[model samples]
Target: MDIKSFIDSTYLKTAAQAGLDENQNQEVLKTFVNEAIQEGFKLIMIRPEMVSLARKIVLDTSAKLLIGTVIDFPSGNSTIETKLNEASQAITEGADELDFVCNYEAFINGEIDLVKSEILKGTQLALANNKIIKWIIEVAALTDQQIIQLSALIKNVVLTHFSEADYNAVFVKSSTGFYKTANNEPNGATIQSIIMMLENASPLPVKAAGGVRTYEDAVAMIQLGVKRIGTSSAKEIVHRRHNQNEY
Candidate 1:
């Protein structure tokens, strides 16, 4: 299935969040970048603050890996201006792709216009700079209806305002991997949610993020038409693929 191309090897946690000091986090990020280069993964998704660091690590290497960063991270509650500013800075720091957390809370509160405006502006900003845009829907935090509605809304905005060719550069991603849920509910990409996204957001690609930790799960998502899979288990998955091929 060419798992490396489908995978976005990720490490989005900051030093404090990961229970490590600053130097430790830098080391961890270096490891992620090196592993991606060696394994031939499609991209390395890290915090916006680490874009420049990652870019430097890959500069002298022969790997064709791209660098990506998240905006308004785990939560999509940030203002549109804030997200645009974050995206702009990331691009300046050498990020090839930007993953913006969609304003799901606004959408749930019947603020559809605000949600649409945010994505529209964010998409425009990315396109203007020749960077890929990924709108994280945080599907695990939503209901089935919300999933369908949100996917359609993103597709509508892209199709209505942008040319058809630009569709390839934009994507509706599944999750931010940090949404809190009551009763310990799931908080990442689920097969059910991914299917809903693929069905409603056609022509535009779909990226299943969060909780895709195994080779089998990743294969399933790709078979279902998902264009990308975001996870931290890229090495393990690729290793498993290699084992199967050897046998």
Candidate 2:
């Protein structure tokens, strides 16, 4: 399946929250970057601050890896200007892709215009800089109907404002892997959610992020036509496939 091509090896944890100081965090990021280079993963997703480091690690390598970072990360509550500013910095630092957390909270609150405006501005920002953009819908936080509506909404905005060729440059991603459910429900991508997203978000690609921890799980998502798989377990999944091929 050439799984390496489908993986977006990810590490977006904060150093302080992970109980590591700055030095330790850098070391960890170095290791993550090195691993991505060695395994030939599609892209390496890291925090905005580490884009340059990841970019540098693969700059000399023969592997053609892409550098990706999150914008408005776990929460999509930030102002449009703030997201654009952060995205501009990451692009200048060598980020090839930007996964934006859409303001789903605002969408649910009937601020539909704001949500649409946010995505429109963010997508335009990335496209202008020649960087790919993925809109993270954070499906775990919404109902089935909301998911469908939001997916269609994002598609509508891109199609309405941009040319057809530009559609592929943007993606509808599932989950930030950081949204907390009010009732303690599991967060991130689920089979049901992925199915719903794929069915609704057409013309634009789909990226299934979060909760994809095993090789089989990832393969299942790919079979469902996901253009990319976002997970911190990318290395493990690829290694597991290698091990199985040996037997």
Model 2 agreement with the true structure over 106-222: per-residue lDDT tens digits: 999999999999989999999998888999999998999999999999999999999998988999999999887778776988999999999988989999998999999999999
Q: What is candidate 1's lDDT per residue for 32-149, written digit by digit as tens?
A: 8998888777899999989999999888785788999999998889999999999999999999999999999999999999999998999999999999999999998789999999
Each candidate's TM vs. the true structure?
0.98, 0.97
How well does candidate 1 match the true structure in TM-score terms? Answer: 0.98
| Model 2 lDDT-worst window of ten | 54-63
TM-score of 2: 0.97
Q: Judged by lDDT against the true structure, how good is candidate 2?
A: 0.92
For model 2, state the Cα shift of residue 83 in Å.
0.5
Q: Each model's C-alpha lDDT? A: 0.92, 0.92
Name the weakest run of 10 consecutive residues (lDDT summed) in model 1.
Answer: 56-65
Clashes (N, CA, C under 3 Å) per candidate: 0, 0
